[model samples]
Target chain A: MSKIGALIFGFNEYSLEIANNIGHKFGEIEIFSMSGAKEALEKEFAYPINRFDLSEDWGDLNERFDMEKSTAFCTLDDTAENIFLTISLRSSFKNLIIIAIAQNKESADKLSLAGANKVIPLVQTTSAMIADMLDKPVITEVLHNILYEKSSLKIAQIRVDKDDYFDGKYPTDIEWSREHGVIVLSVMHEDMSSEFIYSSKAKHHAIKNGDIFVVVGYERDIEEFEKLIGSRCDVSWSHWSR
Target chain B: MFKGWIVDIAYAINVSDSYIQTKRFFYNLLENDSYRFKKYFDMVMMALIFASVFIFIREVKYHVDDSLLFFNNIIISLIFLAEYLLRFWISSSITEVIIEQSEYDLMLSREFRLSKALRKIARQKLEYILSIRAIIDLLAILPFFHQFRLLRIFILFRVFKLFRYARSFQTFVSVLATKKFEFLTLSIFASIVIFVSSVLIYVMEANNPDSPVNTLYDAIYWSIVTISTVGYGDITPITYEGRMVAMIVIIAGIAVLAFTTSLAVSAFTEKLDEIKETKTVDDISKLKKFYIICGYEHISKEVAKQLVKNSNSLIVLDEDPKRVENAKSDGFVALNYDPGNIDSYKRLNIDLQRQVKAILCLRESDVENVYTTLTVRSIHKKIYILSLLMKEEHRNKLLYAGVNEIVYPKELVGMIAREFVGKPVAFEVIHALRSDYTNINIEEIIITPRMLRNAPLVADLHNARYRVILLGVYKKERKRFFFNPIDSTILEEGDYLVVIGNVLFIREFERSLYR
Candidate 1:
């Protein structure tokens, strides 16, 4: 069995999501929160946990957790103050990977100065969210597949507007794979539900006005597809709320 | 006659045609004269005639046979009557004595009737001061018997005739006319107090021997003196009823004085405050072609310093007095008030908003900058605005909010730093270009399509007007800059010409291109 340990501190909804996401990545994940991670274990999953107050002594936290065994410590505190805790942990556990959140540029600077392994501003998350929505329904599912099941080819969403020439065509009839070097994985209709267009059920379905075509291609091929779509097309996701 | 003399003076001053003709007539009358003393002599004679009227009034009170006074009065009346007849003869119309000669001519030439002429005469009567004064002078010199000595009190009304000679008196009259409503309110209050006090005194001291309020007339005189707060002490109230009336009068007098004093003080203070406020605004605005920053926030300090370093005039407008004072302490011209207020804007002379080179709104919040941008755009549509946007989502909103440029400070600083770390030398060059301390830089210019005519190539533009090199031209059409354009590359009007040179040469080059 591969022994893997995770340290989660300052856990909120976002931190909990990150914890849940990271749990599936490893064989054994030990979660720790500055508050409430232990209580959360009773609902669905069980892991060895340690709870510590943020205001408590750093020395007591060092004595409690075995730093060498912990593979990664993630801080989800949306402030520069989290970097101090990260620094304290980094001093005890020299090889542990530390990732922390920053509220803004100024806080990001302080976090970087405090020697966290990685510091990401909250705005960076928004940027990532924007980049993801630019790829939409399938891209999200593909990301989930890659992170959980180690998939190579991934699904991505592409918008079809009035200006696009591919309107009113069936996906199966179009030679997207041969001509454009991309595969049509699925199609999302105007009602915002996805159908696997390459499957038998969706073979007869014609492309409508507000259809989103799900494509699976290499990164370079995706780049080429984006260029073909051109910069004039508005790539915002109307369904997702930030 | 006095009207003719005034017209003569006016002609001597070259103000009217009749005056000019009369002046010529007078010049002919006093020809071969080394001294032009007739004008001065006439004025002195008029003064003496007025003085003698007053003297005659005082003398007639003592004696019945005032021979010298009567003779003097007759001579003055004859001179005045002759003068009046001469003025009437020289003029073209009967209405000339009352209406202005120019107005009379205008009306008569248009064939106005007697009724129309009378209306015109009445309208001009108030304007014809010389004619009115001459009429008063005629009344003063007219002879009267001992019983009509009371009529001689009309001679005191002649004192008003001196006003025509006095400039200060004319000014006082004009001011009083303008402030007629204020004076009327004051006088009404005074009259009410006088009427009430007089009636009370008459009722109270009807039988008191020591009291000066023995009659209604005496009571009126006493009331006048008391309410004026003069307290002449020529009259006193001795009875209980009299004392009660006196007490009420004294109290009312105090109230009236206080009320009038407060009114004067408030008006004076308000005027003084307005002047002071305007002076402060003027001091800030006198900084010619200054940048007006409409808010005080974190970015303002750096912006102010940067502008100051470039020797550019800066006027900071902030509602917080302390912030304004702080900016002033930091060597910036600052106005400690809202720039958006109409009165404040007026005081700053910002209605002529073209004088301001640029407006900057860097308030902590995007909403505040949005409002400031709107106000700036309303005042001057072309003024360049650099505003700070708090959120990335608000960037589009602020762009449509009328700001020429929106800066997300966090993102900008981060990007700059990132560039600095990635390409140090390139970052240094960009920094030097942006700095006030450095000489070389890239400049952005807007060219319209019309300016593309004749194809003045960019290569020839180098050292054409100033010793500046045209590095590139950014065409909005192409959405890219053409680096180092040759003679073959055609120059277009709406192209932004990026030039590299010293600051002085760059400025001269810009001026030449624009000119």
Candidate 2:
């Protein structure tokens, strides 16, 4: 039987849903609510659930959690209390993949401080949603479709390399949509908004050194774009590596 | 020869205390105290001799005993000639004056004398003072003609002496220097206005003889008075064409004045508002037992509702006064203040230590959260500071500032959304606590220092029939929490028992703890 992954002690409903959805993809799913963890455990015979209340004494929790056997323990609680619980449980279940939720940048730091393996922020997800919506559906849909197919749709932002073929050439002049098999959907201007989408009417829109191209392409195309345009991926993976 | 005589006189006038002391020493050694009197006598005798020469020259000019006048003039000239040569003989040589011990001492000690001692004083170069003395010397010895006596107007050159006393003139110079640009701009603008108005008025009023403005300068004068709004009415433009020009000038002048006034007023008003807001925030913060809401929004409204129900002491701080006023109108004790300012915290009596129990930082910006937490920590380190951070990156910064709790609205909302989608029952319980329709609410009770010493077990509270179930205990010392412990687990000091039921259960649980 595949090992069941359980997300416990989180205050958020969406986190539990996400964990359950992710868990259902692999094995049995269980959510041990922090508020009613004891009641849930007392009625364990009636329901297939595991309970762990963060409000309990740390000593009792440490002893009880040591006996549990699960693939991982994920927490969606955005409090220092939840993060401390996750860290304390990490020693007993060294192999348990610990995923935690952060309320904001501060809580994410606390989670990182508590030695969480993965800390996802709720704000960044929302910001990403806003960024996607503002950038338009067509480009987002294309990126989504590619990522959905289990292929990393690397949308890299590259500065126009002065040495490249399209260095000083305008977007219209290059005819990028037909040549590279990848669309240069938009360009991030210095003022922080997408530009080239609106520059289609202008006869000559010269590419500058600092102009970042938001190109949609496959892994190979991304690699080619990186090599040709001297661009890199925008996602900061420093936190994940740590 | 004249240049040498003038240099000697300057040397005498520019003498220092040290030089005088050395001169006294030489006089004492040479028994030359008589030389000082002798020098004065020689100058007087020289003046008398020059006077006689002047009288003789007048006699010769009138041809009255001209031969006798010539003889007298020659005798006086011979006497002055001897006197001038005698002065050179008595005066110190250039080399001796330059190499003198006292001169070298004075040069080393004084900045002014150092330049003089270096033979830097060139003759006739500083002729402003030299000319006055030389003229007096010349008047004493030279044969003066009556016809040339009218040339005394040359004495007016004495005004050049004012430049030597120029220190007092610095203030005037500085005023001119500073106002140079302003004066230039004003003059240029005035000239343009005058030129344009004059040309227009002249073209209009030139055909009409009845018009008072006869010349271009007169029209310019009228334009100045009219545009300045002075309306002296000394020169009126009677013609309709002239009046039309005047109307255009008046309108332009009014616009310029309005533009200038509005710019100044807006700038001053903005600064005044900022200062007033700062002071008001400081005044509000000074109140005891006041609650500080860091941000203004729906969450702030919820926080305010809970705070106002328990206590009337509450002050809401927001960058926007409209939002703060809106909160105030809603029966909240609100004050428009920026929590980032130290004065805002201090105004709410936050520094009183015991008065402020909690600080709620609910600003949308994580940067603001970090700043507020740091500021609050400076005044009261132990206060229950709850901050809302927009980003997870600021958690460590908030924690380092001694913040006890942090709330992320987006994360909480997302979690709530997920719960509503997946587990409807759990969601309902949370909804009741947060909903406006419900009276009952769930709040975390902090285990006080007093409660820990009593060592009350979970089962011992049965008399109260507190439906509250002991879910867990958080051990602060071990920095961990126990969840769903067995019934036999012993209750220890400093253990927080997480219980669930209702407000009544919470009250009973506390009551049982006392028992």
Candidate 3:
């Protein structure tokens, strides 16, 4: 139901990496750069590239991005240029969710004033995180370790019993209609193998006993979700938020 | 006085251009030290100094004529006086050049602080003359005070002028400076021992005729010779107490001598290392395809672990002297220069546009990382710029700055986590299929000229002798990825195929296809 998109504003290594990486999360991803320059860099990218004139009005872009269905990323490397892009995009569409990249705190403040919903600081994005993530039991296990550090979000692995109401339904369909705090990240099969929830293979897999669901939410939502699907481990870290 | 000087020098500067040229010429000789002719001026100054010292020594030894003495002392003094004043006149410009790019803010506020402008020139000249170098210059010409007979010995300070010419002595002097505390402690202890021992020995042996301890001078001289272990037989001890004192002095002297020697040796090694560290950039430029890793951090630790091996050359640029020293100790090429500045980048002379195949911007500050990436990108478009983005908001900005690869750990890990949950075995299979000197490997092989002759289609890969799966076809013209293209899909020259199979099998298939 989320019409999220990654709209990159430059044809660069940083932009291309983002497009390659964050592209899968978004249903719509559009890259804009200078015409011939975009075409020349086009050989290196798998994402679709569109020609954009920085000085022009965004009449065509406004028509393309539906407000309710779009989350646009304005990523020009220059601080002044990025602020101008945010201002231009925000002026064109008042309700659009515009996220931008900032080089420093000053630029972050300016981007926020220019109507960007979020500004990513460059310092915290070191390869050290990648080195940490590459260690074993990284995903769900590490999420628990981080939660102990006083994060508001909590992730718990729950076993889906055969007697549970979710047994006969598909994982994707169950998530679509369910109204709960829990967002299912992945599900582990009875065979002890995991699959991301809603993937082509995961969409058809039926819920069953001894099946594990890795869901993320606040403490209460996670607790309530735990009640519905029995958790193998003790539920704790609820007081971590304070 | 100004009007008289202009009229007196009219022959030398008949035109305005001539006046300007004369000023330019002196500015070069005195202040433009890096100029081709600055050294000749220094040589003349050095020769004048030696001549003055020689004349002074000659005057002391032989009674010279009154006029010749006047010429040697007064005329030479006059020449040095003019040289010293000329140097002082241009000294302010040297300070200005040293602080050139640093006065932008001061200039901006000049209108508000007009009162400070009144004495700025006079203040600069006064400050320069009071400095150590200026004082040294003044000392070299102080024979003008031949009026004060006591001050005439200060002319011997001309020997200090040699400190400027023989630069190697500067290193030795600095090494001595580093050992100053130890040397001071030794000197204090030795002085007290010598004084006390000489007084005691003189009292104990003054009545004995065999001892040369009659006067205080004889006793002092004997104590010094014994402490130095140079026991000149002309001053031997006769009394039992005197011999005991000599034994203690010789023991302390040997200990002090050993300590001094070791201290000097260690200091020399440290200075040698310091000298090598300063010239690291020169060493780096000789090696091609070396990576210039900017900044020192935990991330660089990981980078160093992997990159330090395999005959790969690396140079680190950091802003902290301590960090540079630490890197050197760990056997790394490092210099304390901020890579964000264009001047700093140019000094490296690494040919960033060509020879530097990759640059890693790993500074702790996101702003510095961004600025460094921008500078590097401007210098070289083809370089593979790898950077770590600390904030998600700056991703687009860094991407725009032309970073080839950005490691957003949280996002990338989150994505990987999401993928792992969906198809755990698939990623592992993909991982095992990585192509790098391995048997079972996956690689993206482009359509070679010979391979295009066969006009291979998507489904034709299964029929080949070697087992390789056609995972995807990378369309060159469209710049798109087609996962599992249909049998109807046609392949062309320059088209790349992402294949998964054994290394030897892939090679065999390639040979057969080309054949």
DockQ, per model, reads: 0.02, 0.02, 0.04
* Candidates in order, interface RMSD in Å: 18.8, 22.2, 13.4
**Overall local distance difference test of candidate 2:** 0.54
List, residue by residue over B1-515, the lDDT tens digit for candidate 1.
55455445434455567766775575433331222364464466558657656576668567635665665555555655565455444333333433455446556685324455456656554344357665675565444332565766655544654554453455445544554577678878888988988998898897777766778999999888887788999888888888888888888888778776666565556555444555566566455577777776546766676556556677888888888878878877777778555455665755345467677776778888887787767766787787777677788888997888665644533333233222222233333443435455445555544434423676445443364545345665775545445556777666677554566777876655544
Considering summed lDDT, which 10 consecutive residues are worst modelled in model 3 chain B? B94-103
True contacts kept of 3: 0.06
Model 3 TM-score (2 dp): 0.37
- Chain B TM-score against the true chain B, each candidate: 0.43, 0.38, 0.47
DockQ of 1: 0.02
| Candidate 2 lDDT by residue in tens digits, B373-448 | 8877776657777777666667788888777766654454444333322322223333333333543433334456
Candidate 2 per-residue C-alpha lDDT over A1-242 given as tens digits, one digit per residue, 9 for 90 to 100 = 23433445543444434553443233444555556544544453322445465554445433434323432334545476767777776665554546566655577787767766556655543333322322222323333343233334444456665535665666656545335645454565544444433243322556776566755456776677667766663321111123
Shift in Å, residue B208, candidate 3:
3.5
| Model 3 DockQ, alpha carbons vs. true complex | 0.04
- Report iRMS (Å) of candidate 3: 13.4
Cα TM-score of candidate 2: 0.30
Q: True contacts preserved, each candidate?
A: 0.00, 0.02, 0.06
Instruction: Show the colliding residue pairs in model 1.
Output: B1-B83, B1-B84, B11-B19, B447-B493, B447-B494, B448-B493, B448-B494
State the weakest 10-residue window (summed lDDT) of model 3 chain A.
A233-242
Q: List the candidate 1 regions with Cα displacement exceeding 4 Å.
A: A1-242, B1-276, B284-288, B351-353, B378-382, B417-425, B436-470, B474-480, B490-515
